[model samples]
Target: MRAAVFDRFGPPDVLHVVHIPDPQPGPGEVRVRVLAAGVQPFDVGVRQGNMPWAKVEFPQTIGQEYAGVVDALGEGVRDLAVGDPVLGSTMLNGNAELLCVAAANVVRKPHNLDFPTAAALVAASQTASGALLELGVGEGDVLLVHAAAGSVGTVATQLARLAGATVIGSASFDNHSRVRRQGALPVPYGEELIAAVRDTGLQPTAALDGAGAEAIAQSVALGISPDRIGTIVDDKAAAEHGVRVVRAGRDPERLARVIALAAEGKVLMPVQAFPLSEVVEAHRAVESRHSHGKVVLIIEP
Candidate 1:
């Protein structure tokens, strides 16, 4: 198996592909031949040594979400068979050509959803859906999403609208059209965000921040109650502003719900793809914080 591994915590240049022993499934797990994998900010953070809490070893494989096909099942695994398409969250091994995960954790991929797109939805879907649930964003709520052109922000914007909330998303001027297509009224980030939101004629009742410090403070300045404001990006800013730090941790059921919505065509995620050989560039893109959508590595195809 070929996997992307970093020998040291540093820049994306430290990451490289290496051939390693194929990972086999343990009891209650299945080995997947990865087709596509989503590259997230989490991967960049861990690679750059920003997340010291995550255990890292030399030559560590680094990726968190994958979409692939099941080729082998562990003992006692039933309900899923060889060749079934699946997509789900994984821990630190999704950048590889093969990975093993608990069979119970895998969500069956819809026939209509392509591998890269399925991989793209894994993390963002779970995060966005969980955040909205925590904030109670639904009918009559005008929700403001910071970094609205981002992977998580894009999903959050669409899901909020489906729940009957009007969404205003903050993005770069070049991405405003993309944000609007996701059903958000797009505004620029930084100093002008407040004025732009005001021009929309919608006072935000709830906010989700995926950008950093300025975003949290701006959400506060917009007059949304502190409790109704959430930040997934900056906990320090979240604490300083007395807003909710939306952990939005992993929940298989939550991910499955979004996957179902995606399958039914009610949810969609745009994907920016790179081949597995370009793993370094993929990391650079995520670190750049300007990729229009989910950054994914096409591992198999």
Candidate 2:
């Protein structure tokens, strides 16, 4: 099996493709033939050794989520069988042709989605779902979503709107149309953000920062309750500012909802697919933060 492997944290150039032994399913686990693996910003942090607090176990396999078919089931795994389609996330080791994970971590893939889109949906969508819940957004409440044009922000806007909150989103001026397509009122960042929200006379009751921009704190200054403001990105600063924190990487329920939405077609993931051999480029694209959507690495057909 071929996989993207790195020994030390650095740039994308440090990633290399090599023939590694195929991973076998252990007890309560299953081996999946990878169809597509999701690339995330955290993956970049891991590659660069930036997250000293997280304390990554080195010689690490770096990927957080994937969509694929079960190729083998290990002992004690009764619910999932060979050939069952599934999607989920983990701490690492997903960018490969085969993945071995515990059965409890896997969920049935939604009937409506393909592997590529399903691959992109789980991580971002889940985080967004958790964000909505953390803010306690409700009907008649105004929920401000920063980075509305990005993947998680787009899905978060839709979910917030579905929950009956008036959704307002921020994006660069060029991506305003994409933001609007998600059913939120789009406000461009800069002078336009505060002015645009104020002009509508819809005072925000809660806010979620999907963008890591420091300006999110400024948006909170615009009369929204500081306690109700949460961020998926600015975890460290959010705590310091008395804002709520929604941990994007961990929550299982959040990941599950996103997977269900993808399977049901209620949520869509824009994907740029790269073969497993191009994992380096995929990692670079994700690191750049300029890609239109989630970047994924595909393997098995």
Evaluate all candidate structures by whole-model CA lDDT and list the values in order.
0.92, 0.81
Provide TM-scores for the models. Answer: 0.98, 0.93
Best-fitting candidate, scored by TM-score: 1
lDDT of 2 by residue, 141-176 (tens): 988888887878878888888789988898887778
For residues 1-301, what per-residue lDDT tens digits would candidate 1 score against the true structure? 9999999989999999999999889999999999999999999999999998999998899999999999999998998999999999999999999999999999999898899999999999999999999999999999999998888998899999999999999989999899889999999998998999999888999999999899888888889999999888898998888999998888888998898898888888888899999999998898888876789999863
Worst 10 residues of 2 by lDDT: 248-257
Error of 2 at 205 (Å): 1.0
The true-versus-predicted C-alpha distance at residue 85 of model 2, in Å, is 0.2
Per-residue lDDT value at 61 in model 1: 95
Candidate 1, residue 104: the lDDT equals 91
